[model samples]
Target: MKVVLASASPARLSVLRAAGLDPAVEVADLDEEALLDGATGATPAAKVTMLASAKATTIARRIADTVPEAIVIGCDSMLHIDGELVGKPGTPEQAAERWKAMAGGRGELVTGHAVLRTADGGIDRAVEGHAVTGVRFAEPDPAELGAYIATGEPLVVAGAFTLDGLGGWFVEGIDGDPSNVIGISLPLTRKLLAAVGVRVTDLWESD
Candidate 1:
């Protein structure tokens, strides 16, 4: 079976490649802000999972004919802190403001995963789940934050920080799967694939 990733996040792609699976990228084009705004969900996990499912299903339909007998994976990440859920900061000022409140604090990084098994130009099975990791932040000095913000790393990533890039400098620790904070949760993905009757290792590229 072929493996397809329905996301445009470099972090998510990097995580999958590092884990031995070389999935074909199929970036889903959607108005994410509109979806989130109109979405009805009581919890962060639910909202993220819904978004993941939408992405997966959208791409699954697009490629089901060409990539018959394949597993499609979709993922989305968000940060939950101070009773609010936040995605990418999207701007320097917003990034800086988020970091100001997040510094020396803790937040839950939740990643939603969805897997679809396609057969005969349609989905035969689907599964979805979510993972949450506690991220403990370090207090970077104002100057350090300004420099980091200038790099523009945090502006495009969830939680306005990263675990595998410049933002790592201010991440004190993580309480769960480190990969979850980076973007996708390996363990969760594995289970989701299994739930869809696909073995993750089966999708690994042959050496």
Candidate 2:
């Protein structure tokens, strides 16, 4: 089966490539903020999963006619702290504020994975799930925080931080799968694929 990644995140793309999967990229154009805002009272895990499913289904329906046997994968992530959900900080000030709030604190990085299998221009199988990782942040000095924020890395990433980028220095520890913290979880993706009757190895590129 052909594999398609329904997201534009470079980190997510890099994760799949590192796992030896050469998935075709097709970014889903959807209003993420609107979706999140509309989902009232949903838990962080449920909200992410819902968004993931929407992305996968959107892409799968769009390309099913051309790639009937394709497996479309979609993913979304959020940081849950003190019963609140956080996404991308969107601005330098917001990023700096988020870092200040997160310093010396712990939160759960939740990533949702969804897979949609299409056949003969129609949906065949679908599966969605989420993986949670406990992350602890280090209390960096104000100068260090400002310097990191000036890099502009945190503004575009969920939780206003990254484990595989410049923000790594501020991360004290992590529990559970690290890939999930990067936006996609390989192990969780494998399980979701299996749940939809496709093996993870089947998505690997030909040697």
Candidate 3:
């Protein structure tokens, strides 16, 4: 079966490729802020799951006729700290502030994954799930924090940090799947696909 990634995240793409799957990319055009505002969920997991399902369903509906046998996957991530949901900081100053607040503290990184199988202009199967990881940050000095912000990597990622990039050094530890912290969980994705009666290995690209 053909695999489609309904996201524009390079980290997610890299993860899939590293797992030997070649997926076609068709980013969903979503008003994320508006969706978040309208979402009704009691926890981070529920919210992210809703968003991921929306993304997958939107893309699947659009491409179902063209790629009827495709398995579309959508993912979203957020950091929950101090009873708040945190997304991309969008600025160096905000990133720096986030780092300061996160230093020596622990937060939950939740990533939602949704899989939709398209068939004959509709969805044949679907499943949505989420993975959460507890992350502890190492206390960084002001200079180090400022330097990391200056690198500009944190501004575009959830929680203003990354586990596979420059921000990795400041992450002291993770309580669960590290890949989920990077925006997608390979193992979780595999399980979700299986739940929908699709084997992850079946989506691997031909050699």
Which residue pairs collide, candidate 2? none
Model 1, which residues run further than 4 Å from truth? 205-207
| Candidate 1 residue-wise lDDT, 1-207, digit = tens | 788899999999999999998888999898888889887565899889989999999999999888768888999999999999999999999998999889999999999899999999899999999999999999999999999999999999999999999999999999999999999999999998888876777667451
Q: How far is candidate 2 from the true structure (C-alpha RMSD, Å)?
A: 1.1
lDDT of candidate 3 vs native? Answer: 0.90
What overall lDDT goes with each candidate model?
0.92, 0.92, 0.90
Tens-place lDDT per residue, model 2, 60-158, is 999999985989999999999878899999999998888878999999999988999999998899999999999999998989988988888999999
Cα misplacement distance, residue 79 of candidate 3 (Å): 0.3
Residue 192 alpha-carbon offset, candidate 2, angstroms: 0.8
lDDT (0-100) at residue 160 of candidate 1?
96
How does model 3 score by TM-score?
0.96
TM-score of each: 0.97, 0.97, 0.96
Error of 1 at 146 (Å): 0.4
